[model samples]
Target: DFTLEELKSLRVKQRYSFRDQQYNGKFSIITFEEFISIALDAPRVVGIYPEIKNPVFINQRVKWSNGKKFEDIFVETLKKYGYEGSYLSKKWLKQPAFIQSFAPTSLTYISNQTDLPKIFLIDDTTIPTQDTNQSFWEITSDHYLDYIKEYVVGIGPWKDNLVTASNNYLQTPTDLVARAHAHNFQVHPYTFRNENQFLHFNFSEDPYNEYDYWIKKIGVDGLFTDFTGSLHRYQEWTSPFLSSEKDAYNLLDKIVAMIFKVQAHLVLFFT
Candidate 1:
């Protein structure tokens, strides 16, 4: 069991409060370094989706002797395991991953530290940003999207933002996707599940139909699921990228060169 200090310092947590209350009181959260090893060790590629869940809270409670921030440690851990280069790079695809966060400032903070793609998570309309203290409307605005698009590759909105609900009945869809795609930002909504309680009448108790509606009609770039195998199976069945390893590697090399140049230019400007 972790001490109060230790518990307050963790960036990761058990996602569910109901099924895993035992683990909650029992196990310590894994480090980003350990998480990376888990992904890399998978026989097939498995991407990680790490969230800067509570940046303001973490920084307030966790004090390091080095004066390094939690975001710094997170990116450092990733790089220590050779997690550099942009999204879909050879190094990435082999152990593909995305770093996600609700705090836009945290994403910007780590942008200079790592080139790996980041996703901005948008919570419900009522929730204000952790760092900025702005409403959901402020960040979802065109001007904000334009600014953030430079840092993150995509935005993972709450799935309900794309669709509405009334008395447990699913309502008509929203324009969240159209707006995101207009800014050329990828969209990956979250928490697709097979359970009947979460399923809508429109989906007919079939999770595949729900996937179909989201992937085919709504057009999301990726999806997050409790069951990775289902999403993997769906993608394999419907559409698969016939990517050549050599070409992907060469492109990655070029991007790394460009990234180096960008950093060098920044140093020169600062000096």
Candidate 2:
């Protein structure tokens, strides 16, 4: 079995056709510490959403000292980066983060290690869970959400499953979002891209329209977009940041209107 250091020596590449491949082989596989450092060093309060991808396979292949499993090392790395707190807590809001995984068992295993929010990723309806071997139907059921909600704050489902598509045209959305909301669980859909090839016909090949549809119509709590800047801009333009500058502008406008009214009243009184 290859060690972690050996794995880091290998170059990272794009495995999917839809993703950008221009930088393939330019970057080596980064360690968890390196990845965490990138997020922590960002100028803004950027949140890290690292996935414990393919836990079963990772555990079978990778070995650690003290017989630590993959989940153990994963949580340990986050703890080292001070990523421990329940959702929306002061510590979490300061350095927001979410641990995601397709394998339910991996999430369950790490539940006690960190109180950080976890997102259970749901695959296609035909696929089964990587670790538990549970069918998509079984895992997405109301009963399952009830059980899993204890461990996870939200779900990250394949976007198409939430709104089924045929021939690249979106069909009626399923009740997954509503059902998840009913369970007090946030639904964050995945893999929103800006490319025309990825956009549906209903959106007229507009990424903004897709964002509007998902954020406004679908009422999703969060989105997993490939272009974070696109999502950020969309949110900023649609929902302006409620900063002190904005509040000051609003107060200034109110004061100007009040002064105008007083001036008009004085003009009438003088006349």
Candidate 3:
């Protein structure tokens, strides 16, 4: 197990074959605090979505003082950043954050520490839960959703799991989103990208189209896209921002039109 300093010394590289490798090793692994700081410093309000990644293995390898587990460290870092509040509360909306993890036990343990919304990530259907040794089918079952919903506000499933695809083409869509909504839980699927290889054939190689399909058609609560700018642009275009300036201009136009009509009425009455 590498200490935090040792881990920082290592450079990060692209893991996916489809991803650009030119910038490999150009970036270093960042501490959780650094990640939080980056979000806090953004020009606009930016929410942080951090994962308690691989808690089982990390706890097994990393040694901590006072016998604290990885989840403890993760949550402590969040609290240090002033990320406390229940989901959508006034405090939460100002500094939004969501704690995500694939490990159920870790989520449950940390739930007591912080009330920040948590998302239970669902892997591919073939995979099983790392901590509970439960299959995807078992976890996605309605009975399980009922129980897990108590801990998590939502589930982040693989995009493919929501819609069956074969030969890079989308097939029938699943009822997972409907089921999730029925349980009063949000569904935020992950890893959307602009790359052609990553795009399904049905989307015709356009990331915007993919976003439209998910946001408009599938009706997901949120997305985990690699191209945040692309998603932001799409959302802005589809639901254009009504700025205060625009609202003022619209009001001014209505006032001018009303004055013109009233003036015309006075002229007609005199004639």
- Clashing pairs counted in every model: 0, 0, 0
Candidate with better TM-score, 1 vs 2: 2
Q: Which candidate number has the best lDDT?
A: 2
Clashing pairs in 2: none
Overall lDDT per candidate, in order of appearance? 0.83, 0.92, 0.91
Q: TM-scores of the models, in the given order?
A: 0.78, 0.86, 0.87
Q: After superposition, how far is residue 182 of candidate 1 from its true place, in Å?
A: 1.5
Tens digits of per-residue lDDT for model 1 on 1-271? 4586786465545675544455554545665566678878878867677887798999999887789998988887787777777887887786667899999999999998888999999989899998999898898988899999999999999888788778766788887788889998889898888777788788889888889999999889888888788877777666645245546788999999999999999999999
Task: Answer with 2 or 3, whichever has the higher lDDT.
Answer: 2
Task: Write the candidate numbers in order of decreasing TM-score.
Answer: 3, 2, 1
Model 3: residues >4 Å from true position, as ranges?
Answer: 16-22, 240-271
Model 3: per-residue lDDT, tens digit, 199-257?
Answer: 99998889999999998899999999889899888876776454555678899999999
Which of candidates 1 and 3 is the stronger one according to lDDT? 3
For all predictions, the C-alpha RMSD in Å is 15.0, 5.8, 5.6
lDDT of model 1 at residue 85? 78
